[model samples]
Target: MAPAITTLAAAPELSAANTGFMLICSALVMLMTPALAFFYGGMVRVKSTLNMLMMSFISLGIVTILWVLYGFSLAFGADSGSIIGWSSDYVGLSGIGVTELWDGYTIPVYVFAVFQLMFAILTPALISGALADRVKFTAWALFIALWVTVVYFPVAHWVWGSGGWLFEMGVIDFAGGTAVHINAGAAALGVILVIGKRVGFKKDPMRPHSLPLVMLGAGLLWFGWFGFNAGSWLGNDDGVGAVMFVNTQVATAAAMLAWLAYEKIRHGSFTTLGAASGAVAGLVAITPAGGSVSPLGAIAVGAIAGLVCAMAVGLKYKFGYDDSLDVIGVHLVGGVIGSLLVGFFATGGVQSDAKGLFYGGGLEQLGKQAIGVFAVLAYSLVASAILALIIDKTMGMRVSEDDEVSGIDQVEHAETAYDFSGAGGGASSRSTAAPAPAVTETKKVDA
Candidate 1:
């Protein structure tokens, strides 16, 4: 009886590597939140830069606490018919100490919990880009808290958690193709539709305020993505190592070339924004298939992602929807492209268990991939629309026109990013003072 009990208590080693590696992966995943802040922050007008940053930053604090409380249970707890977690064993991380056990790993369950927490933080932040500059901060906060609970958690359970329908069906997401990208993309569309367009979305130039800021954000996102994709392996292995290294170079180069080529062809100049946007497009495209495809396939995925997302961004103009920062375009379209392409480019000649078109596996795998994409899209859109309506009715989602024109940074946060020198040179002068003085200074300098 003693020997049997000891054997039952022993958990398999999660990975072959030591705790140091898992710790690093955890840290890498954590960086993605801040990286996302920079990525989204740079896309909006100057008036709402801080607001964008705040959206991403708040997730780090809020979601981490929620994950500890019951978010993990709802997401990864003992599966409840693959729709949600049933067990509350990890609520408040109870019994999840250094000695706690999980599938194939001897590491503390806390490491797994922390890694997943970062993902939860990022998913809601992804939607914030679509609602930038218009939504009330308090309302946005509450909506995110509720959105994760109602939309994100269940989808996560359905895809990644045990007994999930998609999992049971044997869909190959590899790393959140359906769960994260498709889900976020669909929700972004829903929120934008309900929130309505930003003031002068189509008519106004609405240019990105700082190209440098945009590039910086893109760089951080690219860097942090190493953890986002590679860390999903959750262990140090040859496969994970190769995926991490190749994901970095293939995506960087493919996106850079694709964007520049597109810009040169269409606009006659390769703008910095094009470079940054292309990089992100590549990153999004590779996310779903990075683990399954070869390096050459990765390049194909990234290059196509860049071009497809670039074109998809223009859809808002043609269709008359204001996806403020093109979240639907880059994430949704790129995700679809990646998910489908893997059906053709996957190794083993596409005839084996997971063959792609190029591997002679025919179209069966492609059909399966398409099914996964459509399923996630339909479910996320409807659910997100319902959730948005609920929040709108309960707490109000958008700010008034007056507050919007005054700039969300000031109206919402009561702070401004810049205070021009020599313009408000007098004591007691505030930002509200007329710009006539600054205009005069500018004329004098020009002269």
Candidate 2:
């Protein structure tokens, strides 16, 4: 009999290598939340850029606090109803010993907890892009706090936690295709519906204020995703981890090319925005399939995602939802493309007991994959809408017309993303247009 194409090595009692590797991966994943801030920040108008960044940044602060308090317990604790888990022992991470391994893994429980915390932070941030330029900062903060509690905590349990019903049912979300992307994407759509469209909607020329920032954020997310996907194996120097890493790159490259090609054909220009957005689409699509599909299969997943997501972004125009930065188009749609295709493209050789329809595995995996995808999308959409409505009725969701028109960053954050006031060198004299105080120039826009 042939050996498995991807095989994970049995972990030793305490390999400093694996633990340290996970630690680094955890840090890398942490950086992605801020990188996302830059990405989303650059996409909005200059007036609201700081507000866009704060939306993503606040998630890191809020989710981190909640995760340690009760989020982790509810997400990873011993199963209760196959729906959610709750155990006071795990709450506040009280019972987890310092030297103890996390169940069958080689890393400390804290490493896994922190790593997943990064995910919880990034998921709601992903939703922020959809509701940009309109939401009240206080309302957004309150919404995310409620969101992680009601929506994110339980969804993570269902997909990743021990004894999760999806796990029991054989659904394969190698690393948060359903839990993160689909979950967040659906939630983005739901909240957008409740908050309504940005004031200008289709009439305004809302191009990205800084394409280079978006590109940089895309690069960081691409870099950190290696840890997000390969690290899910929980150990490296293994065949499965290597395969996942390889597939991740290939899929991203393929998706980027496909997206650019589509843009050139349809829009007559291959834009930097398209390239950056394509890379994210590829990353999101391959995330769930990387562990189970071959490198060739990864290309297929990426290419399909690039093309489909490129088209999906237009759904908002036809449907008339705001989706300022196309979160639903890219994440929700890209995640579904990746998750459902896994059932058709999964290979047993690459991953034991994992074979899709094309490999003679039948429709069992496909059926299961669909169930997981729709279930997450449905739950997130409904729950998020309810949360948004409750917040809208009570504290109010949208900023005042004056705040939205005058600028959300100035009103909410008391800051502007740029201060052109210091453009008084040989390149330019002190122009009257430069008003805000110039603090510093942190990054150069190559794009």
Candidate 3:
């Protein structure tokens, strides 16, 4: 999250208004993880539903503990070599006074710490979507612990910390296009590469089990994102946060419409799934660019991200990867689009003076944005792959194929997301289809 830049020659006192607003925002961000769980859970087959939810839910637990221990210090503490940060005082959150304000801001250090903890919680959860229907729970949990320490903490430092290289270089990431989305996206790619595809891969009919649940999750994400975007500025003392709030709404709306339009043209139907995915794409794209772009610029960012991500979700099919729920397509691609577009659409009025190509800023900001984008991407991809490999070599990563085909929820959790055993032979228990005749000829089919 971006802190308000200040030039006051005096010590800043706490403001009840900003602190209350930040607390509410922190709560909002905290809700996004469970929102993500519902979104991902509804997309998988019934047998794997609980497992998908747990993957996202587990991060809230693993990351929170780590963040309290050293994740916060490593991410937001005093910088070292522009690569990482650390402070003995921040360990266990021990030394800071309760009333002490975060540097240059009106909110308390504790408020800022919890607010940032929510972001830390959500970032690793974003990777779970790509590993759906596979991955051992214990292995996945271990991976979150290690990946956040190695990949997320350092990348967050690079993008937002006091002495971070990208921060010093003036690479503008208003929130977490690079640090959160791209970082998680690339890590998803890396881990998926190591774990390989699901057992069925492209063979099974893996459509979402509950579109309504997906829609509900998407709706919650859109609601929570206001805080995710606006609260980055830490306060409403200036109108930049307000501008971010507006940009968030407009961009998300534009993305939904654009994605539906693309779906209608490309697939001849406007699916609810398209609308939900599109809205999320817009949310992802506008995240980093919201503070820098106008509502109109946000529309462009959202629309482009919507159309591009609409097409991108199909890449796993063509490229022979099993990105079970399109995390790489929406988060990775959307993050890059929003980040790069900042180099073109930044108005130089809201966040910083560094303009984009469209504002006659030339290639300077664009070049800087590229460095930030690829730097995070490369490091996360490589580092995450290594972490997953280490876990795979030790405790193993994937469940047995038999367990996977049967169901991960029962195999791993010993429970299921739904139970129809007491339904008195409900529709789910009754067979509705006619028995198929014996096959007479082999036929080639494309899906």
Sort every candidate by TM-score, greatest first: 3, 2, 1
State in Å the error of residue 375, model 3. 0.5
- Tens digit of lDDT per residue, candidate 3, span 342-363? 9999989999888999999999
TM-score of every candidate relative to the true structure: 0.89, 0.92, 0.93
Backbone collision tally, model 3: 0
Q: Write the per-residue lDDT of candidate 2 for residues 265-336, one digit (tens) a residue.
A: 999999999999999999999989888888889999999999999999998899898899999999999999
Clashing pairs in 3: none
Model 2 off-target regions past 4 Å?
1-12, 426-447
What Cα-based lDDT does every candidate model obtain?
0.80, 0.91, 0.93
Lowest summed lDDT across 10 adjacent residues in model 2 is found at: 424-433
Candidate 1 regions exceeding 4 Å error are: 1-11, 14-18, 349-353, 421-447
Error (Å) of candidate 3 at residue 101 is: 0.8
Which order, best to worst by lDDT?
3, 2, 1
